[model samples]
Target: MITRIATLAAAFVLFALPAAAQSLAPYKDDLFAYPATLSEADGGAYRVVDYREMRDVNERDEVPERRVRKQYISLGVRSQQQEMKLGTQRFVAVGTQQGASMIVLYLHGQGGSRSQGVNDFTFGGNFNRVKNLVAKAGGLYLSPDFTDFGDGGAAQIGALIEHFSAQSPGAPVIVACGSMGGMLCWKLASDPLVAERLGGLLLLGSLWDESFLKSPAYKRKVPVFFGQGSHDTVFPVEKQEAFYRKVRGKSGNYPARFVRFESGTHGTPIRMTDWREVLNWMLKS
Candidate 1:
């Protein structure tokens, strides 16, 4: 609990500042990279494959190569003066929640509010910017208050999944969780009902406990794109690599990949990297 508080405090404090002082675009190449080869189970996990293994793999898939213009429509959340309000609901949509074919449910880190997820783009090169780009690309997006997903989080997430499924029927759902919010994601992915409708996972500086990892969800084979930093003090990079390798070593073809940021701290990678392509790949990986 102490650690959670500390991390949350750091996140908000850091986000309150502008990134122009130390933006990631300059260090883009030094901090970002994708796996050269997608792992396969051809006799040995070391086997190479020219094509990425997955149902969404499309070598021909095209993604935006530039920073997109940010767009959004405030849902239940409203901000004016120095005050923020929930209005009548516990969440807010960073983009239109209309006929989007895909929904990106961004779960913010602990002690953070739902409003911060989309409103914090002022810091630049942040999740809100990524959300804006995805939204502009015709995706439904939301970030719920941390309180909604804590004691009663699972039910809330399940309801959103159900709502999106009913709204768009076969549209895929992406749970883009960060930090403590990821705890809910692990449980959600483990659920048989939720797992079936999942498009992919965008794990940004999140952690999966040993137990959930050993559960049936571990074998779900959902395409997961991780953005983790080498200098993360909360969760070490070695553990992330081990989990990736283990998933790859699993019996089925798992489309798993990670962007190892050489010098980024825990939240820096999440805040700095160009996620348009990564998010694009997960939707169609």
Candidate 2:
């Protein structure tokens, strides 16, 4: 009887071994094995394909071209007395200097000028990196100064957009603002008319809360790109992350991206050579 019982126990162990092995197999494969490749026969040869891998490669290779055609236009709008009290108001249009598909309205940060400083609020003398980048991306750049430190400047921009629309109907407009200008950009983005008139919104160093994002107007329209510095002293990464999380959670279908730079201040320097990357993303969006 003892011999028979021992033999039965050994048999049970053998049966259980394969089941245990099978249970662990998937975990091992997930960690170590290359994802299974799908193949299809084309003619006489089998072609192995992976759609995700292809997309990654395509995105990686995407870079904007170096050659850019630029044209400058002087845009002047009448300012109210209140606006004049804030600061000088002027609008400059920069484009391929020829036929362009999209128009980009650029707003500088606090203490920023259209002619001076890089995109990040850093003072790089005589460096208009943002304008050059926009030009390379095949989009027209329009830089406007707000009457009072970029506050209530959206009205001026709206007027300009209306005037431009009268001349050229059905042109796509994109709003790009950094820091304080971002405030105005958000305001314009929430407007129904502006939403219909504009194509997308790009905000750098934006200092707004989730309440602004919760607006139904912004949710229905406007694809936004939010870029922030991870080590930003003025705008901490935690706050940005929290705001992004809220936006993502609220709007499941919104086309919004939050990119965190490894190292930079309020405004990161926009290198002309790096315009390719910026242009590629802008054009693709």
Q: Estimate each model's TM-score.
A: 0.66, 0.58
Task: Please give the distance, in angstroms, between residue 17's alpha carbon in candidate 2 and its true position after superposition.
Answer: 70
Candidate no. 2 TM-score:
0.58
Worst 10 contiguous positions by lDDT, candidate 2: 16-25
Per-residue accuracy of model 2 over 66-102 as CA lDDT, tens digit each: 2111211111110100111112345555543233455
| The best candidate in terms of TM-score | 1
Question: Which regions of candidate 2 fall more than 4 Å away from where they truly are?
Answer: 1-88, 96-99, 117-138, 149-151, 214-217, 250-252, 269-285
Model 2 lDDT, full chain set: 0.47
In angstroms, the error of model 2 at 238 is 1.2
